[model samples]
Target: MTRALYSLCGADERHFFSPHCWKAVMALAHKGLDFEEVPTTYSRIVDIGGGFSKTVPVLDDNGRLISDSFDIALYLEDTYPDRPSLFGGEGGKALSRLVEGYSQMMIHPAIMRIALLDIHSILDEGDKAYFRASRESRLGKPLEDFAAGREAEREAFAAKLEPMRHMLRFQPFIGGESPLFADYIVFGALQWLRIAAGLAMLAPDDPVMAWFERCLDLHESRGRTVTAA
Candidate 1:
């Protein structure tokens, strides 16, 4: 019953850049769970878990398969109650739901714009082709086209994080003294940008940036395992 995480990766398997996957990775580490990461490329996603999902961060714990990052976190929380809690309790779980929504709606689009071309650049040929076709179809534009003017998008992205910055000024993390799944939700998006584009979206002096540094230091610096870009 070896546990394994089917993580999304680029041409370099070490470059696991999926924001959702990073959530699962951090959740696993937060629970003190050890598992093998099965680097999965875009072309291979359909072959995983009997094609149970079309996305990565598919956790295979023993024989139980779970897809979706939030679902994985919930599964980890439930199955490993004795381990460090990812959500802490029902209150934290509800808070994490809000955090997940904020990360997806406010943060994910900004990151996608900034890292679109960079993400394409890191993929293998087949994956690159697949990525380009799928993204272009959805975006109705080429990656380069969509990623253009990203420098301007950065300011807007930073502005959107003001709520988090305000909160961080009062506490070390969104989880008050320590990080919970709430903090990891935002960390995943920033980690995605860092890994795919080597871009730092935050100002060095900002409290949000400071919080990110602390997150990178978690689980014995697990987030730093894959260096930026």
Candidate 2:
């Protein structure tokens, strides 16, 4: 059986914009695994994993379904120890978690709200309704109102990356000499922003942009090949 990854994308199907999906994609590429892409959306997540999962980045490795991007990365590392390592080692595994948490907690929310209106525009009608209701509930306002303040939020988002900026100034990637699951965890956010909003979330001179470009070239520029919404 062929491996298959259920990814979240926009209505265009070509717009694979979800950060979590990118994480899985990068991880699979890192492991040199060929898989079928199952493009999906949030409104349809519950139908994946035989109703056990309600999220994107669900991997059907052969026939076993795995939910959660991080878990999938871990599964890859454990299942394919001989392939290119996603996490360098045990210490790297721990650090990769930190990077993933930072991206999910600190970076993702700000960009999500900023890209809210754009995301809605690219979603299918049903997903659009589900997205608006859930997002507005969390944001406590209409998408337009939230988006009106995005310039400031984007600035704040850039400011929050200062620590990572300092770190990347010395290291080429999060795993020091090379890209790892840690780098992908963070890059997924950049990928998400670029595809969903196509905004310059980082300043022109930021070091993260350089690393992101390198990531795009990985696996035959797989990230770049995915059409943007």
Candidate 3:
């Protein structure tokens, strides 16, 4: 029973850095499932899933292909009912969705601004060109221009995390007592920031940072396998 997760990477195949892909990776670990990671570059996405999707984190679960991070989480939960639950129940699923929405809508954009140029720099030559062209077209600006003033953007990015900060003040995780998929959602965001930009998004004294440290320590310290930047 070989499970392969097609993960997005930079110049070095070991550097798996996509936020959505991180979600899948953590979800798999949360379920106590073992998987082989197939490193896929930005230019290689079309070659995966028979061109069905244009993203990484495509899970080849014993010939059953699943794409999209959220969908993959649901699949794992249903398929491995005996394992640890990613979402505790129906209400948990809904709450996870809300957390996912907030991370994608609010956190990702900010991290992108700060990490865009760094991400470009770490890519292989082919991926660098492809990333630049595609991102420039979508953003309607050069990558450098889009990533300008990144240092100044950090304060605003920190301000956006107040909700997570407030929540962490009360509980160790967004999922309450222990980490749930909701915790992984925000973990993916910060993990992306850490890997791509090598910058600290939260203060060392912050509760959110403490929560992230705990998350990194989960499942045999899986997230720590990939070093920052």
Tens digits of per-residue lDDT, candidate 2, 17-69, equal 88889999999999999998888887778888667687888999988889899
**Candidate 1 lDDT for residue 36:** 97
Give all candidates' CA lDDT scores. 0.89, 0.86, 0.90
Candidate number of the best lDDT: 3
Cα RMSD of all models vs. native, in order, equals 1.1, 1.5, 1.1
lDDT by residue (tens digit), candidate 3, 1-229 = 8899999998999999999999999999999999998999988889986786788889999989999999999999999999999999989998788899999999999998999998889899999899899999999999999988787888688888889889877888888899999999999999999998765756788777788899999989989989997
- Let me know the TM-score candidate 1 reaches against the reference structure: 0.97
Q: What are the clash counts of all predictions, listed in order? A: 0, 0, 0
Off by over 4 Å in 2: none
Write the number of the candidate with greater lDDT, choosing between 2 and 3.
3
Model 3 spans with C-alpha error above 4 angstroms: none
Q: By lDDT, is 1 or 2 better?
A: 1
Which TM-score value belongs to model 3?
0.97
User: How well does each candidate superpose onto the true structure, as a TM-score?
Assistant: 0.97, 0.94, 0.97
Per-residue CA lDDT of model 1 for 1-229, tens digit only, reads 6999999998998888889999999999999899999999988988887798998889999989999999999999999999988887899999888888899998889888988998899899999999899999999998899999799987677898888988977989888888899889999989998888765667788777788889999999989999887
Model 1: residues with Cα > 4 Å off, grouped in runs: none
